[model samples]
Target: MATQQSTGSTLTRAWANTALPTLGAILAVALWWLVTVALHIDPFFVPSPADVLDAFMRDPGFMMNETWVTFSRVLIGFGIAVAGGLLIAVLLAASWTVERMTMPLLAAINAVPKVALAPLLLVWMGFGNSPKIVMVVLVSFFPVIVSTMAGLTSTPADLRELGRSLSASWWQTFVKVRLPWALPQIFVGIKVATPLAIIGAVIGEVVSPDHGLGSVIVGSGSSADTPLAFAALVLLAITGVVLFYLIVAIERLLVPWAAAIAS
Candidate 1:
């Protein structure tokens, strides 16, 4: 009986969470439609919700193809950023001296407006996916490195002492205690980087304007097809939301305790 009640409670909470956000989105969309209809806005300037829908339905295949191009670039770039960032974070956490020497340089590089590099990347890498992927990496890499290092270095004193009392070596202590503790923080970083990855991909696409959703947006705007441009923007927004939720889902699976503790 207790187990059944607990399951029911979980389901209730899940439904509430999902239902609330869905309701809010519906309300927002309704408001948007109402405003567009009442304001007599020009479709070429600010398209109504129906106009955007019509544009999307007009050439869904083309839109989906462009979406795939952008999505692939984001995935490739984000994947590389995750792998490389974690490795570099581990290396830095292993040595204070190395971190001190390297972090400043990384910060300096990160501080440079990433958008400025897009043109240079295009000039060097040409009109290909390589520059877009690299742009995503550059944008998303810093958060992971910073967050992972914080988690790794912030392992509880008690845990470290327990490891030492067990006669555990440095490797054993890090692998068993520090890494597990750091998983939550590492995931936080990854979540933060997700949107940045999308921004980077779009920026790269904007600079080249040859393929991807960004190119569609550019072409539409030039042709004064505001509804089509809005469609691209809507697609990009949906893509970002999906990617972020996917990361959250992975984080819940891997570090369920983090959520429990926070709540």
Candidate 2:
């Protein structure tokens, strides 16, 4: 009976988790359709769902291709940011002098508007993928660094003492204890950065307008094809959502304790 009750509870929680969001999305779409109909909005300005669907269906292959382009850029940039950020965070945590010397400079650089830098990036990188990838790294880097430093520096005093008691070397202690503790917080930063990486890719694409969903949106806007623009936007939204959830799924698999705590 206890086992059955436990299984039933787990199923109930899973249903609630999945069903509520799906229901919410349905209601939001219904509301959007109603608003378009009631307001008698111009399809050229703000398209109805059916109009957007038609636009998507008109050039499904092109839309998918652009999406893939944008996603690939995001993946590359995000990967670099994660690797670089974690390395920097480790160095900063290991040395107070390094953290003090570099933190302010990093903050200043991060303060510069990414959009403003896009044009300069084009000049320097010459309309290549480099600028887009760099933009993604810039946008996504800080969160990871901050979260990782927080995690590493905030390792419990008891844990540190325990490591010392075990006569562990600094490297051994960090690898065996500190890094594991930091994993959850590192995942937190990754989840936060994932969407920003996509935004950075889109911004780069918008500036260049060479290819990607951002370029598609730019082209649609130029032609005043609101439905097509909306379709591109829908694709971008789906991509961001899927990527974010993919990261979350990874976090759950790799850091199950964090997921349990969060739940």
Candidate number achieving the greatest lDDT relative to the actual structure: 1
| Regions more than 4 Å wrong, model 1 | 1-8
Q: Could you report the Cα RMSD, in angstroms, for every candidate shown?
A: 2.3, 2.2
Mind giving the per-residue lDDT tens digits that candidate 1 earns over 219-238? 98788899999999999999
Model 1 weakest lDDT span, ten residues long = 1-10
Tell me the deviation in Å of residue 36 in model 2.
0.1
What does the lDDT come to for candidate 1? 0.93
The top-ranked prediction according to TM-score is 1
- For residue 88, model 1's alpha carbon misses the true position, in angstroms, by 0.9
TM-score of 2: 0.95
TM-score of every model?
Answer: 0.95, 0.95
